[model samples]
Target: MAHLGQVELLTPELDATVWFFTEILGLTETARTASSVFLRTFDNYERTSVIVTRHHTSGLRRTTLRAASDEALHRRVAALEAAGRPGRWIDGVAGTGPTYLTADPDGHEIALYHQTEWYSAPAHLRPGLKNQPQAKPRQGIGVRRLDHVNYLAADVLPNVEFFEDTLGARPTEQIQLDSGKVSARWLTFTHKSYDIVYTEDRSGANGRLHHIAFATDTREDILRAADLCLDNDVHIETGPHKHAIQQTFFLYVYEPGGNRIELCNPLTRLILAPDWPLITWTEAERAKGQAWGLKTIDTFHTHGTPPLD
Candidate 1:
């Protein structure tokens, strides 16, 4: 696998969600249809990395990952078929070419694709720096790129195994309960500590989204994001603090449509060593709470998209 490509989030409050992403988060809206709007961050090379779709309930619709190569894409597809988890092919979806759509063990939609339309900024949006994709926006927080996605799964280990076996993702970190059950797992396809994560759903829900994160250039950017969230009446769910697991400086907030969104800065941590050991934390260790010892809020575990009644 290459890297995370795009994620489609379903939101009942479409206008408010789109407003929050474009105006508050500083994403550029590239296109809009009757039911969905495509958005991208300043540094994203692809045409779009997020799709906010109008739906009955707010949650994830699909998670797309770019393949390492055309050959790698076919290899994974063959592996999926051999494992009896075959997917259907989809073509001509706006910025992307052919896509193979499948589901994880918990039924979260997954899309795999190779061909993509690279973003070419028009005159107004062009960046002054030659290396950058588009000009950084003066409005809102201006996050750099889509960071990672977290999913709430009914069975975490099965999903973890599925990702590992099918996509060749490496487990970076995990949490194991006293019962010898893994409650959470973080996996990566690249050098970044975690590109995908699955945490046990306390509500026993399958296919629900935990949160989608966006990366900031610095810790100061996240702090500024917290301030912006407060000023704009966005619901602050948790931190402008550091996580004990990944050690990312983060801020969690609920968009208008009730989907959890995270703003984070990892501050130079990457899984550089190919033989990097998987770090596991016991239940007792996690109970002590976050990096600076702030007790993890109750909602951080139970709160997920398409909220339980």
Candidate 2:
């Protein structure tokens, strides 16, 4: 089994974006370099869960997953090589060991690795509970850890094949168009319903990111985050509402660099059945809007970072 790990974000407004994450989003800075700064949520086990880097446009740069063991990492690499998508092994960066980098069919970069430096907070931030990563900070939204990420792919099926065949992710839910095509899909590698997601790009863009989500402890934390976004001049793109798909309580906002960020409570529901059947949503069912009645905003359908032509 492999777990969703660190995600690197490229942002044009590096300084302002970093401010938004550290000051308003309540993430802790773990390391920095000439081009990148690494950050982590209070409960992230890895030394750094997010990496903000200088770039001309704001969007996902690369996503990393941790293999369950060195043996697992080798197996995945060998499988990908046999599938004709041979990736290169790199020395890795500040918090991880050797990494194998490859891309999905849509050109989204992905890294698979086995070794990482577990986060060890300084004295003031050390948690009383040994199971915790760090003491919960009394600041910003105080998101727990990196959650799922949704990508906007020009076509969903090829990307889905990469996820399932190459990485061994199982689909938990999907949106089927009237034409009998899957327009969106959610896949999981853990008890949570989804670890990665792919949605049809209305703009027909390849490799654009829909959003990267951060989890909060409860629905109340998500509600409180909505207020925080308003108070801090952050743009609220969508709801403090439940999603019909995963029943996720979510709020979407744009950070300083224009990439969409979601504060959501997804851990409340667990997919425990080993043979959990796939949940398919028909086009008509999705047209009705969110779990309540909030229509999925129009921008959600067309807008993605590094805006497409």
Candidate 3:
């Protein structure tokens, strides 16, 4: 795999969700169907990075990954089939070529593709700097690009192993409990530290999305985002604080669709060394709380989309 691509999010309140993403998050609406809307960040090279679809409830529908090359795509599919986890090929997906659809051990839908329709900004949206993908939005918090995604899994170790073995994802850090179980793990397919994360779901929920993050330029941008969330009556879940794990400066909020969203700046960290050692945090160390001692909120562990009654 090359990197994390688009994510399709199912929402009960499609209009409200679209409003939150465009009006508050500053994402540009590129296209809309009868039941879905496509959006992209200011710096995403692809035509769209987020797909919001109308559904009975809010949760993730699919997670798309871009393959490094056409040969890489075929090789990974062959590996999955050889491992007895075969998935079917799906064609005609919007803005991308034929995709191989599969599921992880926790049942999260995964789509892999190599060909893509790169975004070409319209004249009205063109950037002053030729290198930029599109003009920076003059409204709301202008997030630059899609960051990592966190999934809540019932068995973190199995999912972690599956991704590592089949997808060739490298583990960068993890949390290990005293019982010798990995409670959480961060994996990367690229140099940006982590592009995927699996955290143990105490609720035993399978196929649940914990949160999806977008990147900003600095910590000041996150603080401004917090103020914007406050003014808009959006639910601020937590942060404007640093995480002990990746050390990302973050501000998390619940969109109108009730899915968790994070705005973060990783400061200056990346997995540059090919032989980078994995950093493991013990349960005891985690008990001390976040980087600056802010206790992680209870909802952060328990709350997920399509709420479990």
Candidate 4:
């Protein structure tokens, strides 16, 4: 079911963030109204997009991805009903299949837009940062798209249950550590390895966002994105390492309001089989899978060179 077309972002400052994407990240303003703005990856309608909404409480809100087909999408809808997380299906937008919006316990809404077509268009029509209306964003990073978003829930289990049960999202990688005595967990998604991520960190003022990841198309693009942080004074906490499990290259950038965003690309893709085994790791084995930091943060952070980072 490799039909995830794009992710949507619902933010409080619709107009401001829209300006951020267009002027800063080089996206073209495809459509806009008084309450919302739709940005194309480039000029094309089929490419990925980010939606800015007028409602605001936290910084970033809704996120969406495409479903592989109509049947697959409805199957997911059935799963959602079985799991008791009810949501309404909206008419498909963006030439995407039957779309829907689901809410988390905290009431943050995530939309799923499924494009029924299993096809590709001309490469030029796809969105790229070649002709941005704005020069560059303030903290100017070359982010391709809002790759993944992480959240901090009271317990990630219920949140995990919703995605795994309803959306057919599974943990490609996950870990657990006793949060003192309460048993906390951290997990990653299988769809783009980004379906859902939960951390127990109560460090933020509002306490929802953990981090967001952006996909950089190439190793060169990845480095250029990291450079945006350095050049524009964005606080980069760490990374640009390869992970043994995902085999993807990644780095972290600190944005305003204590939230984090990851820049990543150039990784191997794993196909999900019917009975794909769920591998759980003990702390010891996790360290090994982490490659003792070879393609991970430990290697680069310890080296203090920040070259690959």
Candidate 5:
């Protein structure tokens, strides 16, 4: 099995962006380097789930996935090599072991590795529950763990095929336009309905990010998060609403450096069947809006970072 490990986000306003994750989102700072600060949620076993890097612009730098074992890593690399797009093994940075780094066709960087550093929180942050990673954070929102990421692609089909072929991800849901074009797709390597997502980019831009999400426990948590975002002067993009496709309850906001971040709750339903049927949404159906008929805000469709020219 493959699972999301960590995500690297580039930000022009590094310090402020780090504050947003640590102070606002309630992730703990695990490590810091000259150019990056590694952060982890209270529930992530991995040393870090979000890496905020100093950069000239705002967008995703890379997203990492963990293979179940050394053999699984080799199998994935073999598939990559057969596709004539073999990636390179890179020396691990802080909080991670060696990684095989590659990029999707649209240019989003991907790192696959089997080794990782499990988080060992300091004394003050130790959890009361033996099974939890750290004590529940006391700051705003207090998101639980890194949930999923959504990417913007000029076209979505090639990415769907690329993930399916190389990583053994299976499609769980998608949007098929009236013209027979695929506008968006969701795939998962785990039983969770979806872990990574791609949506049509009307900006004609490739490799941009729509959002990266952190999981919260309940709908009440999400509703409270909206109040926190408003009080803290964060840009509320949309939600505290249910999604029709994955059934995710979501709230979106822009961090100081312009990258979109989402706070979401897990899907009520899991795709437990190995042969789970793909759920398809027609253009007309999608036009009807979310699960509760909340019309997805317009910006949710067009806005992505780094800002297009």
Candidate 6:
């Protein structure tokens, strides 16, 4: 499984969104273009991420991440097609080395591709690279690298089939919740133990992001970062709790525009053996931290959680 490595957000307000990640949530500015700025958690986190694009409406209009090669990319696209899903590839997108466009439940576009060496940038953009003074004490927050992504779909079946058969990501867990006569099922995907996850929607925007998390070195750093968000009045969605798989204490903080950002520690262990069989989740396992009638199921287990459930 070639797991997800980073997530990029396209928003209208670049300055506001960047400030939220930098000052409030503590991310480092790795690279910046006239129209885009990328903040990373560390040099190795997601190869420089959290792209904020200047636009009119503030939301994730598009997203692009990594894949091993063009062959893998074609394999993924073919899988979606076989499952009776719609997907296409962009011949080439400037700034982003290469990419393919795919749509989710809310019709938001996702571009999956690999970047050229031009993207192997160092994360130390201090003392101001583009003629600006360096900001405050964020040595802990400088751009890390790509970690993983969590996406919400129209339904789980299409996404599960597309991801599993195409990209080689396998299910870490599956959730089914019953609310009166209606029941919902969601899927989790991992190159090893989930780099992307999707579930049913209960309200608000369709194709809206629930959250995207990056990994940290120590639980101390993660908790400290969460405190920074609270001090800055960034919304605290949830946090400082132990997950079933990764087992790391994590803090899920919402950015300036209500987009959830997770700052977490590395999983207790890494599933480095790519061929390791994907484990399934029991009913109680999937229901952890969930209630009936609530559509959200935390099937994801790679971002600072364990996998021995």
Residues 1-309 of candidate 1: C-alpha lDDT, one tens digit per residue: 899999999999999999999889999999999999999999998999899999999999999999978899999999999888969999847588889999998999999999989899999999999899999988889999999999999999999999999988999999999999999999999999999999999999899999999999999998899989999999999898999999999999999999999999974899999999989999999999999998999998889988887
Q: Enumerate clash totals for all models, in the order shown.
A: 0, 0, 0, 11, 0, 26
Per-residue lDDT of model 2, residues 1-309, tens digit only: 477998999999999999989988799988799989999999988898899999989999899998999999999998899999858999876588999999999999999998999878899999999999899988988999899889999999999989899888999999999999999999998999899999999878788999999999888988888888898899999999999999999999999999999999998799999999999999999999999988999999988988764
TM-score, one value per model: 0.99, 0.98, 0.98, 0.68, 0.98, 0.72
| Runs off by more than 4 Å, candidate 3 | none
What is the C-alpha lDDT profile of model 4 across 78-129, one tens digit per residue?
Answer: 7777777769978765446667777765555666765643324344443245
| Superposition TM-score, candidate 2 onto the true structure | 0.98
Candidate 2 deviant stretches above 4 angstroms: none
Residue 69 displacement in candidate 5 (angstroms): 0.3
Tell me the alpha-carbon RMSD of every candidate: 0.8, 0.9, 0.8, 7.5, 1.1, 7.5
| Whole-model lDDT values for every prediction | 0.93, 0.91, 0.93, 0.53, 0.90, 0.56
Off by over 4 Å in 6: 24-26, 30-35, 45-47, 55-58, 81-84, 91-95, 118-143, 178-192, 245-248, 272-309
Model 5, residue 306: C-alpha shift (Å)? 1.2
Of models 2 and 6, which has the larger lDDT?
A: 2
Quantify how close model 1 is to the true structure by its C-alpha RMSD in Å: 0.8
Cα deviation at 219, candidate 5, in Å, is: 0.9
Shift of residue 55 alpha carbon in model 4, Å: 4.5
Error of model 4, residue 289, in angstroms: 12
**Candidate 4 displacement at residue 33 in angstroms:** 2.0
Kindly indicate the candidate among 3 and 4 with the higher TM-score.
3
Per-residue lDDT, model 5, residue 266, is 84
Score candidate 4 by lDDT.
0.53
| Tens-digit lDDT string for candidate 5 (125-216) | 99898888799999978998898889999989998788999998999999999899999999998988889999999987989999999899
Query: Which segments of candidate 5 are over 4 A away from where they belong?
Result: none
Question: Would you list the rank order by lDDT, best first?
Answer: 1, 3, 2, 5, 6, 4
